[model samples]
Target chain A: MADREWSTVDVEDIAALTAVYGGNPARWPADRRAAAVRALAMDGAAHELVVNEARLDALLSMVAEPEISAARVDSVVAGALARLDAVTAPAAAKAAPHKLDTFLPSPFDLVRTALSWLSVRAPQAGWLAGATVAGILVGVMTMPSATLSGAETTTAQAGTAVETAQADVTDMPSLLFTSYTVETHAR
Target chain B: MDESVQPQPRVGTASASAAAPYAGNPAGTLMGLGPEPGDDALLARIAQGDRQAFALLAARHAPKAMKLAQRVLGNAADADEVVQEAMLRVWTGAKNWIPDGRARFSTWLHRVVVNLCVDRRRRPAFAGLDGIPEPPDPTPSAVNVMARQQTAKLVSQALAELPERQRLAVTLCYYEERSAADAAQILSLSVSAVESLLARARRALRARLSGVVQDTGEV
Candidate 1:
């Protein structure tokens, strides 16, 4: 089978080709330039379209190219190099971690150290630990009783009471501190 | 501004030679050379952190990039900023630049410049005022200078009113003198699509600037 080439163009195609490539068919794509030339030669309307488009191209060409200063070029080059440096710096940094960063403690390690310190150095550490264990035991022991009591009361009311208690517990620090300050001042 | 309409120096010809002396001197060299390296070859070197190759590529393409950006952005400062940012991307992304063979490096750079200009236009910093700056004319006669400035202003106004894509197509094809295929690659559009945009843009510009265009006569 012989490959078909575009050897003919319609009015619409000619108009579009002129609009894009300008009035010169030579500037059009190689495959379509032959067809465009043929169309221009055969059709008067297509020729007229080319003439009209040429006027537009002429007006466009008259619009001068903006002048760029040597200073502007220098600035752009300098700025680009600076920006490239900035971008690559971070990337290079990420590729190789900082020496100081390696010496810094991880979050889990920090938590384990604090616990160990408290167990060794703080007199109140045993009391706090004992209180936490008792609280957990009480919470476990009272779960069934609380469930049984809530069966007699509305679950909604029980939930509201639990929320109130939680809020009071959250406010305890301020109350304790205030009373402590008042006692110290009175003394 | 009118003088800018004259042809500019080609990127890699005399300019490349002028920059050749600094090729190997790291402290003083702005760009490097490797036996008349093309855009692709320079880019390959740039990927390896070759400062000379980067400088050579910048020298080769920066003028066209600046002109394209200025046409779209309408301000020299903003255009310069866009080119700077775009070139920076070119440098940073050099390693990742996969040559598709369908589009040239220059075409890829054009797309970068166009995209940056569009993004700059949408920024609130440029809102409310006209983007066009009056061209500095060195003509002795005040009348001729004013006339050129007026014509340039009218054209800039008409161009500024175009949609982003239409403006990009016109900048690439008309101002940059790129072929339809090149413009298509720059705009990331099919050739037919670029043609349609050019058609609509021409119609709108003709409608807006017909009276000024007629009055200007030669322009």
Candidate 2:
């Protein structure tokens, strides 16, 4: 092994060696190919260490090849089919519309469909602006005051007390909305 | 969760009429049970509501998927669960299966299995822990199983001794049978980074397992 040209080894060459023996031991370079192996493992004592590691790696690859039982395959298939059946049958049953399905549109879906309809049936720009103003005015007109009238004061206090009693439900966000685009240039 | 609503396959002998007509095709055994009729065929059948075809597809791919999961998780039970979850995702994604496009069914399944395993590995349950106590030697557990298993266990043990990235590099290469390029893709590491990991892992295994076998060659 003396006079062996280990000088030819480089880090990229070492990388190539690892690539060859790294996953596939079948193609591992010969044991006497120490110079190449040394280069692969960064030379020095690492050369020998890598050789031994490769041998151990070969052993471990043998162990990883599990002997799967045919019976296990059958059990797995049956179990899968059972699981599939469990999931799919309910879905098939649910294909028929329920009472809630008939009456309650999915909120997001309803919003999407309404948006599409509005896009199709959008009014003239002037009408749209007038409608937006009118709707805003109506919303402001219908707004309930926290400050109550003389007779409404007692009722308002009682309502406030009842709402405070149910604290968990009080802070929930309301889902109601109507959208209107603001036209800066037109305004 | 509704047990009663689940499809109940009639147990016992099948009626000639009830058996799916496509079940016994000569090509069935030749395909060695891949997801039914390959991606294109399965996608077509699924579009037509052929649940049996979908079942065949799932049954076909489940084993290899489970094996991949097993390799990643290093536990058979967890592997089984991962396969179940992965197959469920496949079934649910059937409508979106693109038969003629860039999506290869095997690649999709592999991605699903890998993602699920990775997710589970990140969970508190499987995050870094001391090596599981080696099982009772098979009278010869680590040594006699075949050089590959011994190499794998040594490598795995050594890898377990490593920082996470190095261990992942080693496991993906040795246990999962991945090429360095493929491992780099899976781990999102550069090819050079992957090489460094493998080198580190090999050095660790060598240091840990050297001289473990004594004269007369006993472990």
Candidate 3:
């Protein structure tokens, strides 16, 4: 609130402000207080109006407000906390997300678990035994695709086959003939 | 309007500190030494479910909140119920508080209290008008006490008879001693609108209290 803000304030405005705020210039809006005080100092009508309002202020002053009790503040806090606890207990029991996380592992948890197992130091004899078995399996499993079961080519062989197929496609003039030719080649 | 209650000037000159704008204890809870945690920081903690911070905030503010609710509802029990609900929102609804726009936490609390008071007003009062406690008048020794009580009852009754917004404006400005700007902020009205409400309320109160004022011997 500033003095300039009250530049538009007029006599009527002062009277209204006085009727609402009483005779105390201190209680008036800050921006308009100086102007109001100046207005009242200069104007007899508004000053009388404020003096009349102050009498009502004196009359309204007799009402005894309820006394503040330390016990009541305690009671409100106790009552609120109790109610909050009661409500929260049932709510937390139903579908607590934090609790749910304990039962249902997250993707990060799965990844962490996998990494932990991978980082574990296996026995040297166990590693040697595993390598021997894998080498034997690889040696016995190295056979032509036709001899093996359906679609059981090694990864590199499958990739090469895909490249050869794509090469044929590149050489084809149109997709209609290409599909037919590929089907024929498959047969 | 409480003459005995000389409320310290909260609204200062334009150059006064604007950091704390709320009329009700602008600096939330202060401890020894440097500035204590403000309402915003406390709210952040409450949002994280910190019960200690919630209790501290409640203790710091619930008295004023309780008083405002009591004045608005006119029943201690109903006032307690609504203020508690408002405090519960402070705990449960802390996440909903937006930190921008120079918003004060106490303003949020007062808004919740006022809105709750308004909602509570819509329902039929279980106690009705008869429930307003009229102090038992007796004994020559207590004439002063009786007179004050009677005057209080007359003023309160007159206040009750006023329109809802007018009564609220009177309560906030006259009783609570909140500045018009602060009252406007709580009521979500323009400053002039609140002033208009206060002015209208003052006129109604003046008309109603003509006999009472004459009896009080105020020239």
**Clash count, one per candidate:** 1, 19, 0
How does chain B score by TM in each prediction? 0.78, 0.60, 0.79
Worst 10 residues of 2 chain A by lDDT: A175-184
**lDDT of model 1, residue A160:** 54
**DockQ scores for all the models shown?**
0.21, 0.10, 0.16
Best by TM-score: 1
In model 3, which regions exceed 4 Å deviation?
A1-4, A7-11, A87-187, B1-35, B128-137
TM-score of chain B of 1: 0.78
**Candidate 1: residue A65 lDDT (0-100):** 73
Interface RMSD of 3: 8.6
Please give each candidate's TM-score. 0.65, 0.52, 0.65
Q: Which candidate order results from sorting by TM-score in descending order?
A: 1, 3, 2
What would the per-residue lDDT of candidate 3 be over residues B136-200, giving only the tens digit for each residue? 87789898888777887888889889999998888888788788777889999987888789878
Q: Write the per-residue lDDT of candidate 2 for residues B73-192, one digit (tens) a residue.
A: 767777777877777666566666766654456557766877888888788775333235455566565565555445556545555567666766666666655566566676666766
lDDT of 3 by residue, A1-187 (tens): 2224686556787776777787777778777787787778788887887888788887777776765465676677667766766444322433555565578988768755654554565556555655655665554454223222224556666555544555544322333333443343444
B210, model 1: CA deviation in Å?
2.9
TM-score, cand. 1 vs. native: 0.65
Q: Candidate 3 has which clashing residue pairs, if any?
A: none
lDDT of 1 by residue, A35-86 (tens): 7888888899999988877776766766777876655555566566556666
